[model samples]
Target: MSQTESTALADVSALRADLDLVDAEIRALVGRRRELSREIQRIRQASGGTRTDLTREMRVISPYTEAYGRQGTAIAMALLEICRGTGAPPR
Candidate 1:
């Protein structure tokens, strides 16, 4: 193989390693968010409030939409669903 080809392959490998670290960090943050969300749900339920709040969800969705358009909205909604404890769907 040419020297240039070998260097490019090594670069690709390094870049993928970086991507792996980023993926790990993102997973950690998501897990933390889920923990926090569940705790909030518990407190809200204790206070006789619904687990999911549509108005607040919209607020969450808005920044995602502004940052990434349609795809961001989908990402935000998915996160919301994942964080919400198993129960009836929010109205």
Candidate 2:
């Protein structure tokens, strides 16, 4: 094999390794978020408040959109669906 071809293969392998590491970190963060959601559910139960809060949802989503440069509205709506199913309000 040519030297350049071997170098390219090594570079690709390194990128794959980095991606795998990032994937694992993403999974961990997602799990943590789920736990926080559960805690929120418990708090709302204690307070006798609805599960969803549209205002709170917007607030929670804005920063993520700003930081990540994605569609905050869509993500918030999807989460709202989950919250609704859990007896949370749109707001």
Candidate 3:
């Protein structure tokens, strides 16, 4: 390949590696969030409260929505689904 083509390929490879690293970090963070959410769910259930609270969830979704617009809202909802009580996480 020409030098320019090789350089572009190298840049793309580097960017893809960076994206892989980011994906791993996101997975770890989501796992941590899931653990924390489940703990909160346990505590709340023990205290006779509901496991999921919509008001608090709205608060959690707001910043994500602000950052990603509609996409953020969808992302936040997906996170919530995966982190809640027996399923995924929470707010």
Candidate 4:
């Protein structure tokens, strides 16, 4: 390959490495969110509260919506699903 092509390939590899680090960070944060969500679910059940909190969810989604526009809402909703599970009614 030409020197220019080799240099471009190296840059792409470096960027991919950065993306891998970012992916790891995101996975760690998602696991932490899941743990926190489980704790909240436990407390809510103990206190006779419902599992779903629309108000709190909207609050959680608000900043993302503001920062990223429509895509932010989508990302927030996906994160919510990851942390809280689908909105399936309790058995």
Candidate 5:
């Protein structure tokens, strides 16, 4: 019932609101990534080939991961797993 306690609760609520927004954005981006993977699969199928291209995955993920100071290849590998789970063609 203290003012300090109420202030802390308000701050927590604000942080949760921000986090919810971020979660929505993350979900949207993931959906877009899945859509792109489907398009990639279609493109490969039309070219009479199968299997996702690892190099293409690397190319797409590298810059994004690099900005996070992480290994791009590792990020690509993780995405490959996610893509497979979503029914995208395997690399």
Candidate 6:
């Protein structure tokens, strides 16, 4: 390959490595969020509250919505799904 092509390939490889790191961090943060959600569920249950809190959810989504517009809402919803699981009825 030409020198220019080789340099471009190297840059792409480096960017991909950075993306891998970001993905790893996101996964770790999501896992932590799930753990926190479990703890919150425990506390709410002890207080005779429902597992899902719509008000709190809106609060969670608000900042993301402001920062990222419509996509932010989608991101928050995905995070909530990861942390809280789908509201599926048991068989």
Q: Which candidate is the best by TM-score?
A: 3
Give the range where candidate 1 is weakest over 10 consecutive residues by summed lDDT.
82-91
Per-residue lDDT of 1-91 in model 6, one digit per residue for the tens?
9999999999999999999999999988888998899789888989999888999999999999999999999999989887785645223
**Candidate 4's residue-wise lDDT over 12-85, tens digit each?**
99999999999999988888997899789889989999877989999999999999999999999988987786
RMSD of each: 4.2, 5.4, 3.3, 3.6, 4.2, 3.3
lDDT of 2 by residue, 1-91 (tens): 9999999999999999999999999767655766687678779978998765668878877876887667766666655555445545334
Each model's lDDT comes to 0.90, 0.73, 0.91, 0.89, 0.75, 0.90
Tens-place lDDT per residue, model 5, 1-91, is 9999999999999999999999999868766877777787888889997757767766777776777556765766676667645545445
**Predicted structure with the largest lDDT when compared to the true one:** 3
Ordered list by lDDT, greatest first: 3, 1, 6, 4, 5, 2
State how far residue 36 of model 5 sits from its true place (Å).
1.7
Better candidate number, 1 or 4, judged by TM-score: 1
Model 6 / residue 64 / CA error / Å: 1.1
lDDT score, residue 42, model 6? 83
Q: What is the TM-score of each candidate against the true structure?
A: 0.91, 0.70, 0.92, 0.89, 0.70, 0.89
Q: Identify the runs in model 6 with alpha carbons over 4 angstroms from their true place.
A: 87-91
Candidate 5 Cα outliers beyond 4 Å, as residue runs: 70-76, 85-91
Q: What is the Cα-based TM-score of model 2?
A: 0.70
TM-score of candidate 1 relative to the true fold: 0.91
Question: Which RMSD does model 3 reach against the true structure?
Answer: 3.3
Find the 10 residues in a row with the least total lDDT in model 3: 82-91
lDDT of 3 by residue, 48-85 (tens): 99999899999999999999999999999988888884
